[model samples]
Target: MTAPVSDHYSAPRRSALAATVVALVASVTGCAGTRAPGDEPAPTGQALVIGASLELTGQGSALGTQQEHALRILAAKLDVDGVPVGRTRRPVRLELRDNQSDPTLAARQAGELAGDEGIQALVGGTLPETALALEGVARKRKIPFLSLAPGAAVTGSPDDEGYVFKLTPDDADVARRLAEAVAAQKLRRVAVLAAQGSHGDAGAEALPTALKAAGVRLDRTGRLPATGSDFRAAVRRVATGRPDAVLVWATAPDSGAAAKELRRSGYRGAILFDSGAVAEQTLRGTEASAVEGAYAVHPMSLNGSTLTSIAGSALARRDFMYRYLQEYGEYHGFAPYAADALELVAAAARLADSLDRGRIRAFLETQVVEGMAGWYAFSPSRHGGMEADSLAVFVVSQGAWTRIS
Candidate 1:
């Protein structure tokens, strides 16, 4: 079932909080160092470094690049006053590496990062394969790893995922939302064109059950090529039945490519996408028109609305969006999972009063923070921190992703 939106604060309360947020944003942007009298003295300890192995120049670059931007912005912001760890406030640093979208390379990089004593926590992996690779390394090294990938298997078994946490919503939650959207539109039958990978595997596995519960029939399913070479044949196979709608469960580039191929193949039915399609590449150039009216199940952050209030999550999101716009000129509605990962790490460090890998991991399991993207409630049994209610429906309108629900 779709979750209801949370209640908004009253107008007076919102205005008061908004004023406080304005000051917070000013301090963040200005990097103000002045402290009030009687404030604790700043520490001169070494920076607390976080490591990241990302697909910066490969198939996952569409999402990885955005994450890289988020990490840089947040790292800089935190360094202004640093994060509190006990009585000391230490600066933040990021040691980033490019994994080239290869799972093998990602594993090697994760090993190298985890071996470094200065690197306390790790975050990366925009692709499921890369995330799984990193998870293996985190488990072996006993270091905390925050994964940005949507693959449910990243946290499949909590016993083995004690040191790992996922910042994205679970595949099952996304699938349920998509299925409900289809039912609401009265789309009786739907075909799924899933990409070939662990991400696709999870979606395909959970979708049938969700669609069934929503009272919608699953007409057919086809797999897009792993290399994303040619989607024409796959699109043809899935569009053959002329189902009421076609759901493309794939990441960017593939997501937009499949939409273009579907339109070219003369399939004019409604197009639906998984959260991975929220990347900038999905709506760029000709592909924008191809997916103009396509709907997607994504985090509520995709709305990217102007700041009207200053609730914790809303304020953080607004500040993040403002910083992102200053750095990149445009916000593509992608969730800042990397930013939240960094914040989560810092919060854990503060809670544990130490930077020890095991201590950070232990405290991480107890956090419940309102982050930039959404609310994350992490615990010993639940490593997939993003709340299900954070998922919402979005549609491509005028070459932009606009939240619909």
Candidate 2:
């Protein structure tokens, strides 16, 4: 069963909580709400339950764990009493289920959460396939789904994406940033190793176009199951190509394993990874030297200057980082995305001044809010919420992620 839990900010920080709540509510309602017809009234006098299905114990666990932590933090921070909706204090409950990194399980649990649990909105596993699965449930159930993963196909067109939205930037942008890195490094030829799934397929499909734009040649390409751990053969195949750089588009430990293997295979070329591959937990099994000098293209949250610019002030950014570290003990790459997803939902609820799914969805379609990761704006035709400018490239140096332009 998905755990149904509620949390609120520390009692000692009432003033801060009020301020944050005001900001969240105002950010959405300042120019929100053009409701559609045939909307139903929301339930009253009960906890507004939102559901999340996360890959908490499998290949995606490294990032999933961070996502869960962020959910918990935002659930507490934004758990306001008496929101703008008629000055009514409503307790927001987050029900989380572990999908174990399985898309089938994610889809199944998402159905249960919507059909049986009757949650108002859905958040879920950090993969494109999972996003696709949850989107189906959202469409059928007429509830909103917020994805924390990168997948361009998740929102193929505006016509099919009324209730589905994503917090991460599109895969095309990530690939373009990666291509920029290749050009910046002056590498002409590259080998590709990507996971097998929606996220990987999207990246793999976009890479060739991006590479072509950068005048880089794709010499070799290898595909691995998202759950596949063995990369000895794939690494050898890619290494033998002797490309100027090896581009790995995968998640944590798997990509880390590929990086380690690339080094062991004596491939003395540059290594570049997709954003999802560079979290701290993902690099634990691999040696630091294997990752040293390897570059990755990820969101701007990984860089202080870019993050401060989006977050509005140095002090506000510092406060969020301090709170996150204090609560979670360690930071994970997907944490900020998860926080932004939940906070955006809460803000939509406030802006609509009701818990009705139709009203909230309507508000989200025109909402613009500054999240911990970056700015998010949604419209009838745009459901992903982020722009290409949200991405930045980073290099692993001395076992830490350092931003490079």
lDDT of each: 0.82, 0.72
Model 1 residue 337 lDDT?
87
How well is each residue in 271-315 modelled by candidate 2, as lDDT tens digits? 988888857755565457788888887776774443323333343
Please write out the lDDT profile of model 1 over residues 155-248, one tens digit for every residue: 4355554898999988888888899899888889999999999988988999999999999999999999975598889999999999999999
User: What is the lDDT, from 0 to 100, of the residue 89 in candidate 2?
Assistant: 42
Q: Indicate which candidate wins on TM-score.
A: 1
Q: Root-mean-square deviation of each candidate, in angstroms? A: 4.6, 9.7
TM-score for all models, in order of appearance:
0.90, 0.85
Candidate 1, residue 333: Cα displacement in angstroms equals 2.6
Clashing pairs in 1: none
